[model samples]
Target chain A: GAGVSQSPRYKVAKRGQDVALRCDPISGHVSLFWYQQALGQGPEFLTYFQNEAQLDKSGLPSDRFFAERPEGSVSTLKIQRTQQEDSAVYLCASSLRWTGGTEAFFGQGTRLTVV
Target chain B: SQQGEEDPQALSIQEGENATMNCSYKTSINNLQWYRQNSGRGLVHLILIRSNEREKHSGRLRVTLDTSKKSSSLLITASRAADTASYFCASPTQGAQKLVFGQGTRLTINP
Candidate 1:
């Protein structure tokens, strides 16, 4: 793909339901990131992947929030027992390199609504 | 926690006017980046200024960084209605791969 791609642009789930969001990064991108953006706020870091390795998960809000990049190119973010506060836009970004000066390209985010 | 803080949460300006947005950060960074988002969609990379560089230009966009003051500013010259969007400043977290973003400045370029 020419850019990062996210699946199911929108999702609505029950308060206790579990939901999964997927991301397909640009071909051969070495770094991938996930972020959560609340209404009227900046994107908050959720996790990061360097290839298949999950290098950082400190930003995950809770135990229920999990992410994986099993194959290094495709990643999944799963939220269990979703709460109303969990409603936000989930964003995916990928960078060709992990250097400090490189800019990551973003995908159209998935808007999640927990009812 | 967010490392950067953007000033003037919202700005309304007429087309053809220049728009300036400022951002301040707490920690030292290897680089600072500016991104633009439209209608809550994906973000597009605008420009980046390294900590050592004071200024950079890309098309109609100009970015400046003051490492001494831990601040940065973005200037858009000859703004157009199409330039209306939210602009954010981001800095990479220390020892981390993720970039921490500021709340953002909502820029409205009215005709």
Candidate 2:
């Protein structure tokens, strides 16, 4: 792929509904990350994956927010019992490696509106 | 959570004016990177400065890092209407692959 790609660019969910966002990282990328951006704020870290290994999930706001990269290529972020605070853009980024400080390419993101 | 903070929540400037935004972070970092974003969109990587490096330039963008002060500044020379966007600074956590971003500075270049 040309760059990181995310699916379902926009989503509207009612309170307590469950939603899953998908991300297809760039070809051969070894690192993937998830972030949440609220209106008028910067993106905040949610989770990170080194290949298929989930190395960091400290940034996930709660246990309801689960992310998995089972095959090391495509990933999924699932939010259960969505709340109004979940109304934000969910972004996915992939980088070449965890070291060397390489630049990460970002996807357009999925804007989730919890009504 | 956010680790850095960018000053001047929002700024409006005329086209061709130089736009400057500052970011301050706590704790030590190996590198700092700047990004830009349009309204309700993904971020675009701009420039990165390693801890050893003090300043770097890319096209019209100039980035300076003051590790001693734990602060960095981005200066966009000859700003254009197209440059209107939100700018954020991110620092990767030690031994971690994730980047922690700042609050961001929303810049508007009026034409």
Candidate 3:
């Protein structure tokens, strides 16, 4: 693909429900990242993957938030038992570099609204 | 968790004026990168400055990195209304694969 792509641009979920957001990064990109952005705020890191390896997930807000990149190309972010506070835009970014310090390409993002 | 902090949470300036924003990081970093975000477009990478480099330029964007102080600044010359957006600085964390981004500086260009 030309750029990072995310599915279901917007989502509306009831409290206690589970939601899954998907991301398809650029072809062969080595690094992928997920972030949560609240209204009127910057994107906050959620997790990072280096070719299917979940190197760091310390940024995940709680145990309810989970992410996976089994093939290193497509990633999914799943939130269980969504709460009102879980309403935010979920962003996915991919970079060519194996490590950090490289320019990253971002998807349009998925806006999740938990009611 | 966020390691970088961008000063002057919001900025407003005339279209033709210059706009500047600063970022400070808590830990040492090998490099720092800047990104811009707006309602029309998603996040876009602007520039990156290595620790060894003091300054770098990409068209009208000038980025300076001071490793000793663990800080960086972005300057936009002759800003335009289209340049209005939120800018963020990010640095490597938990090794070098992931980045910890700042809260960001919201820039508004008035015509």
On DockQ, the candidate that comes out on top is 1
Question: What DockQ number belongs to candidate 2?
Answer: 0.70
DockQ scores for all the models shown? 0.86, 0.70, 0.68
- Provide the overall lDDT of each model, using Cα atoms, as 2-decimal numbers: 0.95, 0.93, 0.90
Using Cα atoms with residue i matched to residue i, what is each candidate's TM-score against the true structure? 0.99, 0.98, 0.95
Ranking by lDDT: 1, 2, 3
Off by over 4 Å in 3: B94-96
The digit string of per-residue lDDT tens for model 1 on B1-111 reads 888999989999999999999999999899999999999699999998888899999999999999999999999999999999999999998788789999999999999
Give per-residue CA lDDT, model 2, range B1-111, as digits (tens): 787999988999999999999999997999999999988678899999999999999999999999999999999999999999999999988876689999999999999
Docking class of 1: high
C-alpha lDDT (0 to 100) for residue A40 of candidate 1: 89
Q: What is the C-alpha lDDT profile of model 3 across B1-111, one tens digit per residue?
A: 688999889999999999999999998888899999997346898998988999999999999998888889999999999998999998876465677789999999999
Q: Supply candidate 3's per-residue lDDT for A106.
A: 92
**Highest-TM-score candidate:** 1
lDDT per residue for candidate 3 within A28-57, as digits (tens), equals 898999989888777888888988999889
CAPRI quality of model 3: medium
Docking class of 2: medium
Name the lDDT value of residue B79 in candidate 1. Answer: 100
Q: In candidate 2, how many Å is residue A10 off?
A: 0.3
